[model samples]
Target chain A: MDWTALVLSLKLAGATTLVLLPIGVILGRVLAFHDFRGKRWVEAAITLPLVLPPTVLGYYLLIALGVASPIGQAWQALTGDTLVFSFSGLLIASVVFNLPFAIQPLQRAFEGVGQDLRHAAWVGGLSTFATFRKVELPLAWPGLLSAAVLTFTHTLGEFGVVLMVGGAIPGETRTIAVSIYDRVQAFDTAAAGIMSAFLLISAFIAIAVVYGVGARAVRLRG
Target chain B: MGWAHARCGSVAEAGPGGAGEGLAVRLRQAGPIPLSVDLACAPGQLHALVGPSGAGKTTVLKAIAGLYRPQAGHITCGPAVWFDSAAGAWLPPQDRRVGMVFQSYALFPHMSAQANVETSLAHSARTERAARALALLTQVGLADKAHRRPADLSGGEQQRVAVARALARSPGVLLLDEPFAAVDRRTRRRLQQDLAELRSSLRIPILLVTHDLDEASALADQMSVLHEGQILQTGTPEEVMRRPASERVAEILDLSPGV
Candidate 1:
């Protein structure tokens, strides 16, 4: 079993979780509390990336980050590099692809905490930022944890996005999911089986932690 | 007499008189029928605004707290003008420094009684915050429950902690909206006494909004009977109880003119 693939997959999932957390929180807050014209349309747009075929998202991301595209050209000029076929590109794709998995739970959690608490804090002299930080975030921890766990597991198992954007590069973009595919292609059934087992265990552990924390929050709040 | 003198001294300490000085407010919001209010609160006094639900008792408090901007009107507290339509001066809630205790108690569920009180004193030093919060909780007779979260405590305890939180900032004015409606009767009596004692000790003006006339009569030095967004009458509670301004006021006050 090549440990590097497992290690890289873990790194990618971890990084994706970290980067997506604040974005998911902000998006969840907006979706839960903010009232704006075309709010439903905006919500659908934010969540669209989730339901769209991963391969389609991957294809678009590949094109958008390819050397010929304007975004890729800008990247090339700024960092002397291209995002297409890179691990970083795979990460970006995974974050977008798994965003709703992170956002929906958080939004639901924020909604459950209700507007009354926020209104109270506002009148008590807490600023909007302070209210969110001190009251909203702490109260929504359960939802946030669940969303993060779901996103991490989803990102860890992503095949289409990684396959299309990562290009199965060894030690660079070759995650456990990609490794499993490579092993199956090379007729190495034993290695593929081992990687699959580990992936399942990791996912189970992540989900258990999420549910564990969420249940505790419910118990405390109750 | 001792308590009365102490109360008088506290009022003097609050300023020249101790209670809020000539608090007046008028609000006109945007709608087909805008909200309109005009009333004054004397110093060292508790004025109860009793009305039916949606009669805009809460709106008056929110307007005074700078939570809502009226399309037109003014609110002047003492010599300092909180909201002046002519000058376009509208102070924020923080600047107004008015303490408010909500019906839900709104004690931060994550915080213990002590911490909740401490948060009200953001500008104070950490040691002073803790000390003041502890003292306030003790004053509210919840010193033993200082470490318990709002969820862990009973409804009455949470309300007391909320009152402690409101007083932690030492605001010149206090606003309580149905503060005792959620508590049991026995607890309600204790809370009512605590509020009365607090008012007797501090000389700060209090504005209490409630649907219950009994609550209003018990807590308010002055009473303003409101219905349909209008103040029907304003006077001392005893005077209002003795003389009804109109048939409607008499009916609402649960009173009748002398036979």
Candidate 2:
């Protein structure tokens, strides 16, 4: 099976999850706790990725991060490398597309921590950062695990966005899903089958771990 | 409007043991739990705010703890001026050395009773925090269950943990909001007695918000009857019960006229 492609996918997914974790937590907290003007619009904008077709998302990213765009120019100026059809470009696409997966669960988890507990912590002399680290993090760890697993799994299996932003370039941007597609295109169904099985097993194990740990977290929070 | 007329106005009588400037509070609001409160609880005194559920009693307590801020108010405790709307001065709960027991207890569900109390010792010497937490837990008679989480403890036990956590800071002011409403009668009586004893040793102003008139009469050194966000009268519970200032006060207290 395409081992390099498998490794690339794993690295991309790991990096994306690590990059989005802190951003998701801060954004999720703001969304969960505060109510201000235009809140619904902001929520809708973040949620658009879930409903938008991967092709549409990819097309937007292609324009936003393409060589002709300001971001692409700045990226090239900073790194002396083109962004389009590169691993970095693909990584950016995966991060943007996975925002909903990482943030929605985090927001729900933060919301589960009621106002009484927060007020209690405040009166107990816990500062904002201390309260988040001590109380919010411990109580909402299940949601955090869910966010990571979902982001990783989704990145592994993504096809449309990967093909659009990250072409099947061996050992660079080529991921397991793209390799499987390339295998099928070359009439090599056997190799594609093995890669797909590997992916299936990876996803099953991830989901299983999430349920195993999430159940214990909920029980402990009681 | 005037301190001399109020029985609780003996601010200068604070003993040397009493900490700081007691608590001075004046608040006004038109909506969102409307409140017009001008009250004082001298150092070493326990003052009860007695009113119905919607009468801004808890709001007043929350305001004192820096959990809620009214539109216009001035709150000063000990040497610190907590909030002054006119001067744009305000301190968040962490900055205000106030300990509070919420109605729901609000103990960290994931932490043991001892750890929950330790959360309030944020400014203490780290090496001595555990001993101090155990001491507070012992004071509340929950030292045996120090390692038990809130869910494993009974309602009374959880409430005790909440109390221990509140006192962990050696606060300048202590606030309790319907602290006994969630516990059984036996637990309630125990907590009441504990508070009665605690006040004498704390040497800090203690404010209790409760809807139960009997609770106020039993535990409060001075009590204020509040209605529609306003203090109708402030006096000894005996004085308020025996001679309510107005018919509204008598009605609020469920006292018969001429009694």
Candidate 3:
């Protein structure tokens, strides 16, 4: 099968997961624990990607990172390389499209770590920061793991967004999903079939891991 | 079961090195369990706030512990001003050096019993924390289960661990918000006995909030009756039971006049 495409997909997913991990955790925690005016609006905006069509999202992202846009112009000036049709542009697109996949699990997990535990920690002479590190983080570890795995798995299978923003450039932005589509267009059904099976199995295993962690957390919470 | 001496349990008797005198509070709020309270508990005295569910009993305890801030209040604990709304002086919960046993126990499920207690020893030396935590656990009769997480412990054991953690910091004031409400009757009795025994060693005022009047009379040196967020009466449980001051106080206590 297309090994380079496979490798590129893994690398991109890995980078996206690494970047999303801290953002998801902070956003998730703030959303879970804090009350603020317009919180519902903030929550709705975060969950928008879950409902937004991928191609529609990709089209917006394409214009946002196009040569004429501010972000696109700045990137070219700073890096001397245009963002459109580049792996960096694809990575940014993947991050935006995959926000729900990274954040929802973490928010749910943080919410599960009860307010009583946090209050108890604080009254036990632990600061808010200390309580988070010592109590909330440990309790929400399963959610964090699930968030990472989901983000990685979802990014690896990203197709429309990557294709829209990065095109199908070999070795630069052609992920396994894009490669499979290219193979199918060339009538390379055998290669497409193999890659699709691999993606499907890996996605299944990733989801199974998330479910397993959630179940274990629930049992432990008992 | 022999709670005869427990009624007067160690009263701290103005004795040498008795529980330190602290915990003076006045609070006023309009909603969310609206509270109007003016109360004080001396060193070594267990003051129980007896009330119905919406009487703001837990909120009173939380206010003393610096966990909840009322619209206006002041709390003084052993020469330290924990909160003063007029002055805009509010100590965060961590700095209050207050021990609080939540109704739910609220133990860190991920930490072992010893570690849970050890978390309160943040101010103590690192190497000494384990032994100190063990000592506290042993005091609560959970020495053998130090390595077990909260999930492995029984409800009673978890509550005991929460107590041990609260005591680890040698707090200036202790707050118990229906700490025994979740356990079995037998366990609750045992926990009450444990608190009575441990009360002698603590040099801090304790504020207990409970809906159970019997529990209040059995444990509190002085009890305050709260209704609709207002502390209607404060006296020794015996005094309150015998003379409820108002018809409303008698009704709240389920006591008939002259009974």
Cα-based lDDT for every prediction: 0.80, 0.87, 0.87
Q: Rank all candidate structures by their TM-score, best first, as comma-separated numbers.
A: 3, 2, 1
Q: What's model 2's lDDT at B222?
A: 90
Which is the winner by DockQ between candidate 2 and candidate 3? Answer: 3
| Clash pairs detected, candidate 3 | B19-B203, B20-B203
What tens digits encode model 2's per-residue C-alpha lDDT throughout A94-150? 999999999999999999987788888998889988999999888888889999999
Q: In terms of DockQ, which candidate is stronger, 1 or 3?
A: 3
DockQ of all predictions against the true structure, Cα-based: 0.36, 0.69, 0.72
User: Candidate 1 on A46-120: residue-level lDDT in tens?
Assistant: 788778888898898888878899988987898887787787777788788888888999999999878767766
Question: Where's the lowest-lDDT run of ten residues in candidate 3 chain A?
Answer: A46-55
Stretch of 10 with least lDDT, candidate 1 chain A:
A116-125
Candidate 1's C-alpha runs over 4 A off are A122-133, B1-22, B226-259
TM, chain A, every candidate: 0.94, 0.96, 0.98
TM-score of every model? Answer: 0.86, 0.91, 0.92
Compared to the true structure, candidate 1 yields what TM-score? 0.86
After superposing the true interface residues, what Cα RMSD does each candidate give? 1.7, 1.1, 0.9
lDDT of 1 at B14: 42
Once fitted onto the true fold, the runs of candidate 2 whose alpha carbons sit more than 4 angstroms away are B1-9, B12-20, B31-33, B242-259
- Candidate 1 residue-wise lDDT, B1-259, digit = tens: 7555544443323432233354666666655335757676655788898877777788788888777777777886665677877788888776777788988877777877788887678757766888888898899999899999988899998998989888877777888988988988899998899888888887667899887877877788778887766788887877887997998987877741111
Cα error, residue A18 of model 3, in Å, equals 0.5
